[model samples]
Target: MSTQTQTETFVLHNRASPEPVVHEPAQEPEPELSPKWRYPKVLSAGMSFFVAGVNDGSLGSLIPYVIRSYGIGTDMVAVIAKRYGTTFAGWLVAALSNSTICQYLDLGPILAVGAALQILAHVLRTWMPPFGLYVVTFFLASLGQAYNDTHANTFVSSLRGAHRWLGFIHAMYMAGCLVSPFVATAVASANQDSQWALFYLFPLGLGVANLALLGVSFWDRMALAPKRRRHVAGMSGGVAAESSGKSALMEITVTLRTPGVWLLSLFFFFFLGATITAGGWMVEYLVNIRNGNVKDMGYVPAGFYGGGFLGRLILAEPTHRLGERRMIFIYAMLCVGLQLVFWLVPNIITEAVAVSLLGFFSGPFFATGISVGSKIFAPELRSSAIAFVFVLGQIGGSIFPALTGIIASRVGVQVLQPMLVGLLGAAGVSWLVLPKDAGLHRD
Candidate 1:
């Protein structure tokens, strides 16, 4: 079929209502992943998240090790922060390219490319490459994550009961986080002579499995096809290419024009900043200030991730029922309160429990935001809008941690508390700032 025919069919299928597609008055209910074939695809998406969780989660536990082994920081943590700063470039590249790539590529091939890049990154890290190479791996891994996660989110949100599925996949990510500390800490601490970098081997193996699952599940759609000939309205050759380029550019323009997208992106921005900062630096803080053993403190982050796992599993339905706006703000405030407890209560056990509860409360923020954004944005723009949102979240995810490293290099790791309090409060306020309900976007 011609590109115009495809565009027209999209309109016919999607233009049924002026209101949001989720609430169609007197129409049939939204389709769930009733097709038996889709089960494996969802599983692949979850595995992809799990693989990412392993890659991202292990970094927190390994930070101390990465520092000591490489002599990254002596009096200050500048080198580590500089390393995280590189991840921003990867996410930026993905944000700038996502919409154009989506216009030209099929889903399966995009996912495949992402999976492959991640695997290559892990492979590069397995041998304990140089410091520069180690930092470069973050860029490759992050770029892969951007492609895989943005598309997976876009695909899953398009399904029925997206909240449940989004929670499931994200929870799987927490599960990976939960498990990674044990593995990473174990590998890094097996003996006094333990090679900290060897912990990457585990994710390398998992990345391989993830790629295999993606290839098998997405076999039918997997491809990097040649560009299509555009014959629409007598367009030919360079003119067709120019028109395609123009239309692709317009998608990004429309997504940017929507106020809801930026509002939603703000929520993710602060939410991720707090999360990555907490997870990435919690162990370092414990060791530096609390005088906790590095080995034991490494495992402490598991409590936070495990709480997040259970929270996403348990709270998804309740949040959906209680209302996204009201409940998310409450959860964000709860997170702030828990963060205070974690910060002020000097006891190690108290800090652990508080961080765990904080994770529990913040768990739904990601899936909930995706659910709302999926509904608010037009179907055509969902992929681009969410890609933009995900990138912004990542920008926070990278920035705050790097910033913390920069500040902590001088003042001390104790700065984590106030930074987190401010971020959590900001996140709560941002939630309140969003439209009170998803239904408001109908039309």
Candidate 2:
């Protein structure tokens, strides 16, 4: 009956029981919830495209300001420098995405990394780095855009009603382009000559919002930890890991060898060359060649982008229903005719109208090309194939504008019209040569 004896008896009783009373540990604090859009995945993806549009659209308007700030006569050389950087970064992403790296990651983290790069680019621009260093920002921004937009393109292409969605996203891009010029022009026009660099602050804010949305919308898929592979009855873990790497390489090699990929890439090589050249140089072309008022002409590029926005919105379903192939050919011809008008006309108002009409005709070309690409390649090959085409497109985007600038510095900016005309012709031809049945609805 001693206290020690009683305690010992109680312990014995507890130990002897079939199940002892159990106490749970205190629950850990839940992590803070992230901010997110209430909209679904498709809309989130569209927002990313809109961000890209804003980045791209604003450039044409900003070129005059950039030229003035840097005391450069022609901005084309700077554009080439920027594009060369972008082209290199784009190819780097294409190579890595095709390599074993993608096996361990998903699209979301890739997008986040891209967004971060863009943010850094804007931050650099906001400070107005020396001209040599300033051009480097384009490369950073282009590389980031390639990563983020390529994956977003791939994702949206797989969903139902892909053509409509493709139109929707590209339209968002044009919409961004339309809005950016007005803002950029307004800000630059208001600021002192030394303060032109401050315009980058607007995009810097947007880039931050872009990264936040990408993080939230893609949270579930964002860099999910790679699962450990269960060992086969006789296989070693090292061998399995090695085989995984090899498989990734094989997938990329197979994608590279696809004929459709090469043909599609060739088409975009010309297509994007035309698109970027027109948008990037329009303001300069108008001011210098058309006797346009510098203040008023800065808004001309918006008309081009606005036309594109309307074209994508109005023409998406028609393109799908009328047949993508036939419709594109018609669009190309119309674009050629519009360019001729823009080129031959001496009046600025006439030139502006012609440019907008050209944009309207040219707008569906990109989204439609992607739609066709989605159908031509196998699902597994789609991402790599599209990435390859996009990289080539960036090369064209860089090369032609640089070429235009170089030639313009010699013969004058008047050379842009003829160069664009030739590109449009080549693009039409490239599209005609692609395998006609690759996009068969069945498989």
Candidate 3:
């Protein structure tokens, strides 16, 4: 996920110069700026990830409450499937539109729009909207997240020591995931009678703050690009639109053609799918099969996320130091063992500890993948490629959860274990399959 050590430096070619700088350090020096004032935008981007993490993290804790509040029946299959289906749709829309949108607009307006959509979703949810509308809110939230986060990640992963920054932002995400369950569980159980949906008020407040942060930090890039950027300079409107469309199409085509993109996507496909599935259903499994209390079980996922928070913080540099490929595979194997402990062992306490440890091992997976991807994907295709990978990963995130819910609605949530095991193992194998030499056009 990170660069090789000082002995094996990356040779970043200067586009303006003919010579390559072979002696540059793998860990790039911090940008020369005031000590107190480096990149606040990195913090802003991290907050965006945190907001998304809050939104996603809450789901695992809230799933049981949603089913109970909705008074769902055998059609629970439809309910869960449809809920995640909307999530799938949101990612689908992002996949189709992110590249085109970036072609004409700056990241500022795009991020602003994404934050606004999330705020809108929370607004609708806090009122306890109808079931159908509630599902629609997920679509809005995810679409917003896709836009807001994909770009933020792309921007961060391009910097010096991109791995560390990627870890910071993604670790912020785990922090949100960690904080969310505590708040969600507290709010939900505070007045389980009628205020479960009130949990959204929390994310709603954060969403507003996220938008303000993005606006202030990204002020310069908030508007659409210059006319020359949107089109050929001096071209008429119709031709400009055509030119923009053609350019956007070309980026997507090129991004898709890259083998490294798809290989990374494969790793993400299973990794995200497994994590989302486990998080989304762990509460349900504990409550049903483990016979745990609904109120108490809601807090359990905090352990998972908390472990993840520590893992991302503690593991990023080491993973880089040891070797991203070998270390990730090792972590993946550890996760499989922990998942087995969660499964075979009947003690709820054992399961809880196991899940937490499982999370710790799995946490580095995301930041590491992105750091490596930045090196492997072409710069021109960077934004669209990462966007594609992210949305595809979100697709995996949505699909497995929906599938689990659908199957569990029939066979019970016990199936979550085997599914997770399989996906985790698949993720390990996929990581091993990545090209050993990590850099542009390694495909």
User: Of the candidates shown, which would achieve the greatest TM-score relative to the real structure?
Assistant: 3
- For candidate 3, the clash count comes to 0
CA lDDT, every model vs. true structure:
0.76, 0.71, 0.77
Q: In candidate 1, what are the lDDT values of residues 138-186, reduced to their tens digit?
A: 8888889889988887776655556677888889889899999999999
TM-score of 1: 0.89
lDDT for model 2: 0.71
lDDT: which candidate is best? Answer: 3
Candidate 1 clash pair list? 18-443, 19-442, 19-443, 20-442
The TM-score values for the models, in the order shown, are: 0.89, 0.85, 0.90
For 179-200, candidate 2 gives per-residue lDDT tens digits of 8988888887884564667878
- Per-residue error for 410 in candidate 2, Å, reads 1.0
Off by over 4 Å in 1: 1-34, 74-83, 224-240, 437-443
All candidates in order of lDDT, best leading: 3, 1, 2
